[model samples]
Target: MLPQAAQLLNKIIKLDFQPDIVTYGAIFKGLCRIGDNASALTLLTKMHSAAHCKPNLVIYNTIIDSLCKDSLLQQAMDLFSAIKTDGIQPDVVTYNTLIRGFYNSGCREEAKGVLTEMLKSNITPDVTTFSILVDMFCKDGNVKEAQATLQLMTRKGVTPNIFTYNALLDGYCLRGQMEDAEKLLDIMTQNGCEPNVVMALLEDMEDKGIRPDIVTYNILMDSLCEAGQLEDAAKFFSDLVLKGLQPSLKTYNILVKGFCKKGLMNEADDVLRKMEKDGCLSEDIFLVMTFPRHYTTAIL
Candidate 1:
């Protein structure tokens, strides 16, 4: 469809009807969307040579983004310089695209340098900018730099979002900084970020051979329960036992309370019976026994 549109534009141009910048921009975007950067660049050149229509910042940004995504970093950089030479100031999007490109290409220093140049140009880095930097640093195992970037982000008044915390949490977990990860998790909860947002981190932990302790399981179960995923929580409990990890009293309490809260008396009773079988049914069960009548019926 985009190619057909481009052909239509060519026919219009042949008849001396020059398409406007908006028309050219749409075609450029479509071409870039399909990774046809070659055609997009050709159209950009033709647009530049046309007497009435010229490429704007948006068109240039689109092409630059495509080039970067295709890992044509040098071409993207040349176009970055070209945009400035054409008297067009590169916006935050332009810088961000290049920065992400450099990072994806393993040019960490170049990525950082782009951020520096962006600051020098007085383009205020948004949360996305900081989040990208934090994610890059964390993936590179430079959590210290990630931490510094986070601090700078806050100092610049860009509040950290879930993505920012998740990246740092992943970095800490990757480095076996479980204590720090737990502390960060606590901070996330304190800051009103949902624990379920970091639930995927459990897979990362397993992949990295980081044995999740009882506390970690408790957090996972609690998050699952809070999200109303009682079945998943129960499966995780079974997994815990299969993995030879003893379910603590708190673990049983989380599942029992989660089931009872959802009025799942049978499921809650099953967990209680299992708890008794494991010799984990103690007085501490009352702590999570919110439904006294149901608890009395189950225990009896």
Candidate 2:
């Protein structure tokens, strides 16, 4: 469809229709969506040569995002420079994309450099910008730096969202600093940010022969179910059973809630039946069944 659209666009142009920037922008987006950055870049070059319709910041940002996703970091950087040469100021989105691209490509220092440049340009870092920094620092096992970044974020009057806290939590969990993780979790709750189950932390615990208790399993299952990963959540239940651990009522409720949220009434029924078969049925399950469908979905 995109190829056909592109051909049609060329025909319209040949007829002297003079396609505006919006038309060209749509085409560029389509090309990039299909991971055909080559074609997008070619079209961008053509747009550069055209006198009437010069590419705007949005178009440049789109291509820059596409290039970054493809790990064409050098090309992305070159285009960043081009944005300035074209008298277009890079926005927060532009800096964020480049920072993420450089970090993803193992160029941590370069990513920091991009942030510095952004600050120098007086583009105040937003929550997303700080979140990325926190995630990057945490992933590097530099919890100290991640903590510092969090402090700086607060000083800058930016509130740390779930992603920010989750990164730090995972960092502490990875290093087996449960005390600090718990402290952070407390802070998250106080700040109205619920801590999420970090699967990587679970995997690391397993690798270290550290057994997680029922509560930990419940947290993980709840997280998975919330993410609509019903199958995975069910597998975790099975693992809980195989480990001679009892599935609490909350476990069944989580799965039922997940299935209900996805509109899979039959699957939800099967779970309820299984709960009964295991002699785990309780009034809570009845309450869950009695609740209106929308009510069940909302509680999760």
Candidate 3:
């Protein structure tokens, strides 16, 4: 695509059609897409030499984003500093892109430093900004920090969305803080985040009028199984059907494993049959077959 674009640009130049920054930017973007940031930088230098096309903020931001995506953080930061040196003001996209790059590269401190710089510049952090922070903290198992970030987001008048709430919920769930996770569900409702949960948690769900999606049910079922509550997990499986939700392949696998854990060969076989009837293939067939046939026949 880059070669074809370059050929067309040369033809256009021969016809005396002057290519502007936007025209050059389009081709530079294609080079970045192919993971050729080095070539893209060379093109930028060419644009500098060619008087007809001057690099603009969009051009710089595109290269910066591409550099960050390629995990060249020092190069990205160098370009970021150069942007200011060149007298083009950095915008929210520039800051957000760098912050994301740092977070993805596990450079959390640098990412937060970028956020602080953005704040000092009086650039209000957007939902995407807070979402990234929340996700990063949660993934790092810093639930307390994630919760603090969530509070900061609300205090700054940035309403949390489903993704934001979900991140916090996931953080709580990861730490086995079911009580906190349940409370977050209410906060999610109060904040007008869309509903997207567990048993007794299901009772809490009913009490709170929260609807359980398939993911919610799956999480609860998995948690229950992990807690060795196979009976409760089975109930969630039944409730899922009664609620008109189809059990996912994951749902079947969880149930099979839960029953197998309890040496309930009959129940495991039943679920395997149900999974097959549902047109789902069980990846745990070896576990299923490994269970002694004599044990299954005895249970039958």
Candidate 4:
């Protein structure tokens, strides 16, 4: 597909066929996946004007997804407005994509408004939609709202996906509600939706009948760190090494920040040394290491 995407575009242009909606949808998705939104939108506009290729819900969703990939949230919103003005009623996908975009931009308030709009239009929120909202609430540190949205979805018979569970669990863990987090983790497995920070980690671990990945450790590591349980975080990092899973930059950053927060300069230095030794230090983590602060720094 990589070697041929440009070739396909060339063919479309040579034919002057104005790329039908199907062609537009295909190219738009490919462009978005590759983070090429400008060309995708241009093709979208061309498709919209073509009498032979009237845009539908899918085409609209495709464009929105492209805008989102480029982090163009406001542009996506404007496009949605244009979609409405074009007499095309936004469907579930339209609202869902914008909900996700709003969340991505840390605009949870806007996301909430979108949710309200969704309900007003009677477009039933699906599991994926709920999952995004749950993630947004958790990341925003609005655990109460996260829990409420979770319960709301449950009562509406929209079961939470694995992402939903992970987001909720993360919220509880951040707030030092380990017991509650564990309960939800158990229920998630009972419901047969496995957690995957990234899909490869799951399939890789499953193949060896072992569970040693950066994300699993990070979940516990983040929770423990937030709880001021550095012993647990340090131990978890070591356990990951023993299991032959190298710590990702995220894992290293978590430990470094955890130690710094505790004013344990010695421990922080040791962890930073380990990160350098393991080649796990990222630019962002390296920046934090350079700016290590004492406990009193927080008062300023």
Best by TM-score: 1
Each model's lDDT comes to 0.84, 0.83, 0.79, 0.73
**In angstroms, how far off is 287's CA in candidate 1?**
6.6
lDDT top scorer: 1
TM-score of 1: 0.83
lDDT of 4 by residue, 133-189 (tens): 888878878988989999999999997766787678667766766566655654554
Q: Cα deviation of 129 in candidate 2 (Å)?
A: 1.4
Let me know the TM-score candidate 3 reaches against the reference structure. 0.63
- Each candidate: how many clashes? 0, 0, 2, 0
Clashes counted in candidate 3 amount to 2
TM-score of each: 0.83, 0.68, 0.63, 0.59
lDDT of 1: 0.84
**TM-score attained by model 4:** 0.59
In candidate 1, stretches whose alpha carbon ends up further than 4 angstroms from where it belongs are 1-4, 154-163, 186-196, 207-211, 286-291, 294-300
lDDT of 3: 0.79
lDDT of 3 by residue, 1-300 (tens): 688887788788779788987789899889888888988887777677776768898888899999999899999999888888888888989999999999999999999999999999888898789988998999899998998988998898988776676667667766777678756765554444422233444565455455566766776676777677788788778988998999998888788777776788789889888887878875455446665564345433
